[model samples]
Target: MMDQPNPVRVGHKGAKVSWRKSSYSGSNGDCVELAELGNSVALRDSKDRQGPVVSVGWRTMTTFVSALKGGHMGAGQA
Candidate 1:
């Protein structure tokens, strides 16, 4: 079995985060957004910009982005 990664701590209280939705996201209401802050990457719901943001390490974020591009998140794969 694979070990799950621990969630990283984030300070979204006053973060001047610049959120951007996924290019693959269409006119649909379901979409995720991302932002960069120092060595961390912030993730939030595009529909809820004012909601909570989750932060992760740069390396982890890289892996996530790669997986996303590879359609590992069930975005394009049928």
Candidate 2:
């Protein structure tokens, strides 16, 4: 069996991070913000820049996106 990495939680810090909206996002303004920190990637809600963040390794982020695209991630069963 392989070891699974624990989830990351990023929040409650006064530090500043440069976050940008995804280019693929629409002009509706409901989007997510992304920021890079060395090997880690941080994501947060565009509507709440000061809200909680979800950070993960660059590789992990890639895998997650892939899963999303492949329809491998979702709530419950379809």
Candidate 3:
């Protein structure tokens, strides 16, 4: 699986990363931030900038998003 999170801190690897969140996110500060890391994507909590970051392959992220949009995985569907 490409869903495992990298154990290093942000910018620790000296790679340039710009974190951004979905515009649909509410102003209540509940969302996740994403950064493009070459062939992979990095995800972090918007509320915890210094928290853990999960990195997944670009293709994996794309497929995951597609599943969400297609309603393949839902509340009770694993």
Candidate 4:
């Protein structure tokens, strides 16, 4: 069995965050948005910008991004 990742539970639902989606996301807008909040970074779906947000430490965020770039994880999207 694979271990599940811990959920980022820093921010609450509908929190106001300055999020920026990836440029490669294109105009389709089906992308994830990220925001920098002091020592933490927040992520939310572009399609639901006003929805729940996940906040993780900057180091953790960078690690996740690195893993994504290295193909260690998947986007889980079509």
Model 2, residue 36: what's the lDDT? Answer: 80
Q: What would the per-residue lDDT of candidate 1 be over residues 24-72, giving only the tens digit for each residue? A: 7889889988777787777877887767767777888788779888878
**What lDDT score goes with residue 60 in model 3?**
85
**Candidate 4 has what TM-score?**
0.68
Off by over 4 Å in 4: 1-16, 74-78
Which model scores highest in lDDT?
3
| lDDT of prediction 1 | 0.71
Clashes of each: 0, 0, 0, 0
What digit string (tens of lDDT, one per residue) describes model 4 on residues 1-51? 322334464356876556677878878767888877787777788787557
TM per model?
Answer: 0.66, 0.66, 0.80, 0.68
RMSD in angstroms, candidate 3? 2.8
Residue 13, candidate 4: Cα error in Å is 14
lDDT of 4 at 47: 89
Q: Where does candidate 3 clash, by residue pair?
A: none
Instruction: Give the root-mean-square deviation of each candidate in angstroms.
Output: 3.7, 4.2, 2.8, 4.7
Error of 1 at 5 (Å): 7.7
Model 3 ranges with Cα > 4 A deviation: 1-5, 75-78
